[model samples]
Target chain A: MIAEIASVSFIGGLLSLDVSAWGQIMVSRPIVCGPLIGLLLGDLKTGLIIGVLLELIWINVISVGAAIPPDATIVAVTCTTLIILTESKLSLGSDFHGSYRMVVLALTMPLAEFFKTIDVKQRKLNARFVHYLDREILKGNLKAVGKVNNFSLFLVFLRGFLFSLVAISVGVYILPKLFSYLPYAMLVGLNFAYRLMPALGLAIAFNTFRGL
Target chain B: MQNLGFLYILVPVLDKLYPEKEKRIQSYRRHLEFFNSHPYFANVLVGIVARLEEEMAKEGEVKSEEISAVKMSMGGAFGGIGDSLFWGAWRPFTALVACVLVIIFLGKWEGAWLGPVIFLFLYNFLHFHTRFKGVLEGYEKKTKVVRLLKKMYYLRTIWSSHVVGLTLVLLTGLVVLFRDWEAIERLYFLAFFLSIILLNRWRISAARLLYLLIGISCVGGYIF
Candidate 1:
């Protein structure tokens, strides 16, 4: 369990870098990251389902201009990780697994906003690096250019790594316990919600084109 | 933050163009100024700036202020276009296509992995093309690159993607209805879809909607 958490966190850290710090490649998007994490945890189906769900839900959430949208990547990573890991740990019959997934997704959804707050704070801290580089460049220490950029990127990676490490560590421990405690009625409700999730995602995706 | 990235990209170019330490410092200072643009399209500006710097170094004809002006104007322009075309249109289109593919073939076929593969391949094909080509095109054509961007019919692309994306979304809803869902389930799915679309008009956040759905489901479960 510990090894699984650590490895997933490492990949989470790297993928989070693709969000904005290093590559703006769409790999950071939930569609890619979800399944990637899923494949790592040996659950491609859950990963694909969760990835497509999150991708559609947050399809319109883009960082345009100065507005930083919620960190969908973090939510997708943590949500998929929790579902796969916790589902494996639980002895719940296959019948209840669908409901279990919905419950995990619902609970994990808020992490995107939480991670966004942290992301904003990190970007604010990065401004200090710019000032540092300004000073170094003015001093004819041109080499600091690469150093500062690399250092900032490292911080971004470290932030994602540490966050995912702590998030998955805590989530893996708690989620299954919570799901186990839920009443049968709530589980059924979650199953319904789970089936309805794609509708929500599609609606949001449709709303994105409302302007056009 | 992007300023730092911009400076990092231009370092080797500056190092080569300005051998004198003092001149190199000036060039570095110029690039180290604030610069933010769409990451992929920024390469276009980078290429243009690199060419401008080379000219400034060799011929001393292009003024530093003109270079800054070009950076400011083009940065804003390219940022807008890139955001709309890539982030707004292209990403959603490719992702929706992948998602629909996943929904249609996930359990029924062994080709589910192809969804993400196709997504990555389709997206990065254009992404890398722009990233690699934009630089060369910008370097070769300079400001005339704007003319080339205009010719790409970005608006047409954006409009078509949105249309196709809508169709795919509808198609996905239909697929789920016929394949996995039963009679009551189909009605519930339609109701959820319609309500979600209507609720979206209220500008409710996705998270809130998710929670709301979960809350409602729990109540429905308890009652029925």
Candidate 2:
């Protein structure tokens, strides 16, 4: 299970890198990556559910220009993986529809902000590489240009892989323990939030189209 | 990395334009400056650059400054347009449909995988097509891409309403899934929907409203 989790995390990281690290391909979007991880876990349904939720919620949060938005790929991938894995370990039964998944999602929300900071740091590091490439361009060193470009992509891949690896590693132990103690009332709220979050996400999406 | 991505797209063109090492280096430097644009419309910028570079290579009438000026000016304006068009309109349109499917198949394993697959197909179809065509069109027609995009304004309007309609369907699905909704709770749901629409109409930040709704749900948990 550990080996499987690590490999899946690595792939998820690579896809997440697709958002901007290389091509602005739509593969890294939550609608895709979430179910991708779920498919890897042998449960495409979990991935689809979480993917739709995160994709809708973060529909407006795009990386426009220099501004870095919260990394939804990481959130969707991690949350889906954690929930599915945790459910498997505990045998969370076949009747899993509401609170359990919602709790996992609620817990994973903070990681989006946490990973955003990491994303910003990665970009800042890429800035240094860009500066180095600038000098390489001056020297007409095409070899160095390719090297730097490849290295930057590698760095992004590494950032995502390591982040997910660490998140899932830590979460594997912590989430189950934490879930036992989370109040019933809080879970109820999460279930409500689960319902409300879609509308809220849609509202945000609608806000973007206001001028049109 | 999107800043660097522009260089990648231009590398082949740069190599083709400047045969001499010194000329190539100079051309490379011209494009290596800080660049960030809406990813989809970047094709337009790339297309324009490709054309300008071609002109520079053939006629030498197009100065590097003119090229740089176009890059600087067009990037921001087109970035705005692309953001609103692709990110704002196209994405939400696809996502709303995808979300509706997820809601429809909330617990059905057989049907669950369909939503994300459809989403990727629809979105990438639009996303990649625009990217490829934007570049080709920009390269072929140059500044006329703006007018071309202007002609598509009605499409944007139509897509916007699709988003609104899909959103209402999603909200309706949520309300249906609640199992037992009292009259007052139904009214609150209606108010919640209206308030968000109104807040958006007034141009209040949706982020603030999102946080407020989350907070209300969190604090109001005890009441309901």
Candidate 3:
């Protein structure tokens, strides 16, 4: 549970900080984060594997204007993590691994979308926090800076823990049933996402480049 | 290499637009090398360089060649290009295309990891090599980048759109080939292409048509 909690906070903190707070790093991106979470859960291979698809597919899902990305990497990582944690591989002696993995992916995707909206809303509300940080910077107040950074990191992790918990929980509950029913439609939808989503990624990357 | 590829597309834009001293270009080239050496920071590094150049111009340390009017005449032109090429064309083309390839081949997820790392190699190689070429001769960098872009026969914006279109087409093809998806998607694609043809005839801007198509699809997809 602690590991799970830490994983979510690191992600949430990095995400919230990327475009909104310090804007210092985008390395915390899905390509980076997916492998990371996989390692944290003691499954580096799975993390690296999922990271690859999510990274390539959504490489251009960087921060832009008012628009928020569908967060492909987060979806990949969350889905993978949830699956590996709850379902056992051959070494783990769990017979339900195959079904669990598939069901988790199916369940975790919608959960990812739900959390994205929440993150976007949080970002919008962060305007005042941004102003406050700016003022503290202007005043050169170390105490203020330290306080804000610490508090923000805490809040970010708290949010991640809650989101991850709910997401994983819901995945465990109804995923197997739903997956059995709509595997066909879901496969089609994912294929659609994989191909078309890349184009969307290009639109994003191009939009960020300076006009010649 | 993807970053390097992007550099070929962009840094030449900077050199042609700025045309600064040998030292600046040399320093700039070094900076690009540093930027691309790290896999993820390539575009952001370019953006940082652009910002720094702008600041240098403001301080009267350097003169603006083409980017001079960036604030006034450029009208967010540089920003738009950066956004388009880095975020839009190079990143997505490098990324999503690979994603499509992975799924199209039905590769195992583990094997698909090469897509991004491959991009990294492509970008860095191109970035450093082009910079070195630029410092060796005047206009050399411009010639090289232009040639690269030309051979690709693709503008960044257009290329980005093409990636999107191709990926969508592939996805649709896969869906049809693999499983019985709702038959409605076929109708939806037909309607989308038809509307695009009709709208283009009326001379609606492509951007507007994009939004219109999306809007129409969402609404139509919902009802039908």
Better of 1 and 2 by DockQ: 1
| CAPRI rating of model 1 | medium
Per-model lDDT: 0.86, 0.74, 0.45
Quality class of the docking in candidate 2, CAPRI style? acceptable
Say which candidate scores most in TM-score.
1
Scoring each candidate complex against the real one, what DockQ results?
Answer: 0.75, 0.44, 0.11
The pairs that clash in candidate 1 are none
User: B75-152, model 2: which lDDT tens digit per residue?
Assistant: 888888777667767776777677777766677456766777788788778778888888999999887778888786
Ordering by lDDT: 1, 2, 3
Indicate the TM-score of model 1.
0.97
Ranking by TM-score: 1, 2, 3
Kindly give the number of clashing pairs for every candidate: 0, 0, 38
- Give Cα distance to truth, residue A162, candidate 1, Å: 0.6
How far in Å is the alpha carbon of A4 misplaced in model 3? 5.3
True contacts kept of 3: 0.07
Arrange candidates by DockQ, highest first: which order? Answer: 1, 2, 3
Which should have the higher lDDT, number 1 or number 2? 1
lDDT of 3 by residue, B60-134 (tens): 564444332322222233334444544555555544444444444333445555644555554445434434433
Evaluate model 2 with DockQ and give the value: 0.44
Q: Which stretches in model 3 have alpha-carbon errors above 4 Å?
A: A1-36, A39-64, A89-103, A133-162, A169-212, B1-75, B100-112, B119-224
Runs of candidate 2 exceeding 4 Å displacement: A91-97, A183-212, B1-3, B153-159, B162-171, B174-224
